[model samples]
Target: MGDNTLALAGGNDKKWSDITSQESTDINTPVSFADTKVKNVIGYDNNTETNVRVATIEDYENLRDATNREFAYGVLYGDGATETMESIEDVYEYYRIENGGRGYPESNRGMRGCFVFNTENGNNLFFPIGATGYGQRRTEHAWYGETQLGAGRLQYAWRNEEYKKKDELGYRPLFLDVYRRPGAIYWVRTIPTNPTNKNKKYCFLDINYFTFDFSPGETEPTLGTGTSACFIRCVEEIP
Candidate 1:
């Protein structure tokens, strides 16, 4: 009659002994529960005050696989305000329709390949594979300089001092694909350290046929000069 006890017909109480004999012989044997059991475990959600489906190991594996695929293609999802790595084809279709049906151009399509460079202050930093150039003389100036204005810009953008140092030593990120264009020069955000005329020199990447020339100490051209028309490579942050 107690709440924990189960009563059968004729007011008889049932216990584990009564059900043990009825159970299949295979029940006692140790068998694999890979797919047959624990498919969808239900748990109560305190915040929503409802029952929610709990994620299993399989669910985590699927998510990790999907994320790897997204990272490979640099696919992004979400509205303009927010973005995440999911629903690749849907976002691509939306982007294609929004951009006058032209989608992305071939030369600049490499920009779509983005990978997480690092995480700082709870935000993820991503660097695109391709670079973009500002029109006219604007492209000549390094966005960050050795002057007071550009002093902390590199640290602010990249956040990790060690990675910046590695970058200065021509360290290429493993996630980035080999740039299609060889002998291409691009402007990096890091400012070179020059005791004399600090504002005049800025760090630029002289990408050679097989390797990167990332020496920040070497001087290139003065800022705002028309001769240094280097493509601008940018790093973006996402929360």
Candidate 2:
């Protein structure tokens, strides 16, 4: 089958006629085909479906093996309230399994892991591969703050003590995340700036040290006056 075609027994989408035979089977179970595999691993959701497992290639730049007992945490930022580190790990592992327990997918192709970040100006930032690729680029930290966006494992970002200088900054981050290879341990990039900085980016800043605010207007206002409005652009993934 092609790469897009998920090798599921019943396939990803099953038409009504494919399963509405009205057979007196277990209705509660997701209508999937039974497997005769040797080792059936139970998923967190009590799912018995044999996940398609793929092997992870251990390279100095891509995948790193982890301890079976030890757990890795992540500092999540861009994810909304829904996706957490534990949930991300669950999805990560699920894909690994779907690829035959190998963390690497068989049809590996490089695509920019970018996202669209709208700027105050009439432009857009196509940040391909947000932190994941950035983490892979940096060589400083072994674990970036991307793990907290995992599945529902833990949420420590809301804690005041975890965040540094909370009184001044207004957010508290109490956890760390492994950015991963093809990733980084700690991925810190900078906010885009105008030509005023001469293209020198303000990357890898300690977010705990900055303050953020968004003030909009009909047109850009001046820096210091009653009607004058200024927007200081800053972003942090931690609490």
Candidate 3:
């Protein structure tokens, strides 16, 4: 059961034609970029003007608390979504998890996990650093468990990287959904884990707002991390 897309030995090979009975990707291809463009929809006017919204206090907090750089984030913003939490974080392990490097090269941090801001403490460190299965009745297995890496202490598996390959673009994506809002202004962070190491620097986003758009369950999985990744103070007007 490998991710046939990259020949990875885990995800299964489910043919697209088998599922849709189509031989070509013509139907799947988007015909018009303008049709999917986010314009006045999020607060945009026409092509020349925009009605961008100002940032609010909560927006600021969410921005400060979120990670500016991105390793693996949700394609959308909900549960059971296409690019869910479990799936996106895998993006981190591939690029950042090279041998003897900045990431968990020693694989000590555990398995496919995530980091998110929890509170606004004075020192600003109320983040969740445990398993993706914190509490409640939810739990999940690593995308590439012992199947990929040896069965080391998998308890803290959430902390370590997940893949051993790169994405389609060679470089990982920085923002999760930065282009959601056309006129509304909101952003997270992209702090470098090692300020001195420029190559390992990455972006972490804190907020996402899509005024007139609807992704439904697109963002569920990426956000399904065991804990909250952003502080998300508000979702309303700035003033």
**Model 3 ranges off by over 4 Å:** 1-37, 42-62, 65-194, 203-239
Off by over 4 Å in 2: 1-90, 93-161, 172-194, 198-239
- Candidate 1 positional error at 50, Å: 34
C-alpha lDDT of residue 191 in model 2: 25
Candidate 1: residue 134 lDDT (0-100):
14
The lDDT values for all models are 0.30, 0.23, 0.26
Model 2: per-residue lDDT, tens digit, 169-206?
44334222211122211111112232454344322211
lDDT of 1 at 132: 24
What lDDT score is found at residue 157 in candidate 1?
A: 19
Q: How do all the candidates rank in terms of TM-score, highest first?
A: 1, 2, 3
Q: Distance from true position, residue 21, model 2, in Å?
A: 62
How does residue 77 of candidate 1 score in lDDT? 38
Comparing 2 and 3 on TM-score, the stronger one: 2
In model 2, the number of clashes is 47
lDDT of 2 at 150: 22
